[model samples]
Target: MGTDNRKNLRLEVFGILKEAVSILCKNINFLIFTIIVSFPLLSFMVYYETFLFKTMVETWDLLSPRDYSNYNRPLPYQLITENMNRDFAYKLIQLGLLYLVPLHLLELFTMLLTIDLASKIYSSEDRPLTFKEMIEKPIYKAKLSSTFITSVYVLFLSTCTLLGLIWLVINYSIMLRNFIYNVLFTVIYGAAFVALLMKYLEWSAQWNVSVVISILEKVKGVEALVLSAYLCRGSEKRGRLLMLVFFAWGVCLRLPCLVLGCYEGGFGMVLQNVFNSLGNVIKWIACMVYFYDCKTRILEKKVDEEVGNVESS
Candidate 1:
């Protein structure tokens, strides 16, 4: 019984993976358009971050004397004392938050295209979407699904961070308390994060579903989620294992870019670059895959249930 269940799960997840990948491979033009739309906005985000840091440094130098021998306090102390760099950093942070507004819209648009492809992949009949028609009228059943997806992740991360802070503050009095507390908190919270990641696997899958169903007008978001979860129910362990597989794949891809980023600067630059790359590339994919399979599997399950009901009822 267990073996049968496991086999079914593997088959369903395989369906989801093929659905997602085939869409990208099949609809090259739609994928290109998504990237093209995102490039300018993404480039601006990079430049805006770059300039903010540069400006902050320039402001610091201008305020301070070229030669600080005459000053009573040391440079680091003086910067803190005079309130030198804090405001610049704060402003840059605010700009980053605001910039996401445009990026969010761009992501939403791409998601619409991706979801359409997923729906078709699972369309028992394999109803593939064409480039010309898809561009003109994209699917949106998964539009709000994708939005809710973004919301859940942000909320999960925020909740975890708040919990960590509480643990730190409440236990600060004991000797070595913060250290021990942090270690324990990290483990527990890390597990929660993993579960959250697991739930997110549907993000990519969900959107793909939307795109697929746009033409057929088959399933909505709620049905899609439940169905996907069911299809992937037996494969949870294998699904998680696939995550580890992707994790290694992603690390290998970014390692070279990270090394180059390091030499592109110096020692401090090296560490910072590597850290940034890890955050953006590695973590980004993990979050993406979590949503990818979760949604696909749920939708696959939904498809079966719907089909069963139609034939039975």
Candidate 2:
């Protein structure tokens, strides 16, 4: 790759921030529409998740005393285990299949509206696909999503390989405090993996952003990825640093119950509320960054290295 313009990314950061503020000012109506329409889906998800019992144990009504008088004897552990597993597997299959119908529509329609908003709002100042433009350019968006998914899957596999090696060590023979070491390794490595995942996501955001432009205008993919990577040499650290900062912030959100426990009620009670809302709340921030990342990545300069090589030869 050509020498990366590290200094240039500072300007990019400022530009994105400015675009964010301006877009926020202009798009309140669209934002409201997004939230209002998405609310029903969100509400239904909550109902399905909480009421329907993700597991049969949570929702099932077993036969009463009169009906089960002959079944009073304690069941065999293996039989009980098999029954529990069967119930869990059944729920898992149903839950997975049930959402595909709604998820497909959201992915196909509602998601497109949001992407369109992103593309329109962020298209200025060399931004590639705005929230709006993505809807406008589905092929490019698909390519971008495909690239991201492939990268994450590869990372996951690599992590699994390393974890497999550790599993062998802990299970194969008598190793000193092997269980303790394994747990410690998981804690340390899991934190590091989360950090890396954040940085990797930011880096990939910089890749293939130009495809939004290309798909809309009919241009090059590799060129977009490379040029964006090159342009992002400096900004990587800033965004990567933000990821770590956010991770720490995330830690604070996670530990609120512990902090709350000291002031008032039992930890268990506090924890129940915290855990219930934590995932969805964190996802809210993620949804916003989804747009921000796409904006910066699309600004990459277009260049076809493959064509250049061919001509040179």
Candidate 3:
């Protein structure tokens, strides 16, 4: 009986994967828009992060003159002095205050527009929208707000789970109390950490479509999460499998860009970042396709039951 259940689960997962890919492939143009809309923003983020770190390091060097012989010392040692780099500190504060608002707006726009585009593409009742039409159409500002809140919800849950697991491990494991690191302890602890991380990922899969719900149903925040979980209740396995595949794909495709960026700067990093963003777009498109399928199935099931009740009456 267990074997049969496992086989059925495998079959369902495969079917879901196939259908999701099919839907994405059928509307490749939507996927292109997803890439185009976000690629510039992603590239800017990559460039900006690299620039920020380099600027800080340069400022640190200028503020605290260090001999080449002391290169082996840790970088944080520069800030150990009673009088730290006031100029660098001021610059950091200025940078943060300057970029916070604009950055938040850009991020919010990206999430809302990409999700809105995905929903429109996957929605059968709606026709494909042009770029201008999408912008000119009154944006559902509430959906964007909800998406931000839902993200906070997930982040808080994940952080709590991680902290709780860490606390439990420390309390339960005598080896950890003294920070002992024998081979046996290392293996056991490593395995436990991996298991916890896997569990967190699986739990997070439940909320994968919350943004989809927020946009389509105009439900935001906790309500979107509740609706998303309800819709995905029976399809948990499929959601996990989908998330696993997407994670694997990201590691395979986007990981290289980060590795490459270390050695190759300037145009090379920008080009690689663009490709990585495109890969992310493809992933989101597939995610949207899966969300559409799950939603359609739920709606159809509800309609069928309602029709049966009416017929009996």
Give a tens-digit lDDT track for model 1, residues 1-313.
3322422442343443443454445556655654554455445445443444455455545445445355432334344446556776676566555544554454444444444443343332434545665567644455555444543444344446544543432233221223453565545545665555554443333333332232234444445445444544555565555444454554564455444543233454434433443333223222233344544556677899999999999
lDDT of 3 by residue, 2-114 (tens): 32232223235555555445434555565565556686578566656555545545543553535535433222334334335677667667656434544445545666676
Model 2, residue 212: C-alpha shift (Å) = 6.0
Clashes within 3 Å, all models in order: 25, 13, 0
Alpha-carbon TM-score of each model against the true structure: 0.45, 0.43, 0.62
Q: Please provide, for model 2 over 183-226, each residue's C-alpha lDDT reduced to its tens digit, 9 standing for 90 to 100.
A: 65546545665555665546534432332333323334455456
Cα-based lDDT for every prediction: 0.45, 0.42, 0.59
Clashes of 2: 13
TM-score of 1: 0.45
Candidate 3 differs from the real structure by a C-alpha RMSD in angstroms, to one decimal, of: 8.6
Between candidates 1 and 3, the one scoring higher on TM-score is: 3
Q: Which 10-residue span in candidate 3 carries the lowest summed lDDT? A: 1-10
* Order of candidate numbers by lDDT, starting with the best: 3, 1, 2
After superposition of all CA atoms, the RMSD between model 2 and the true structure is 11.3
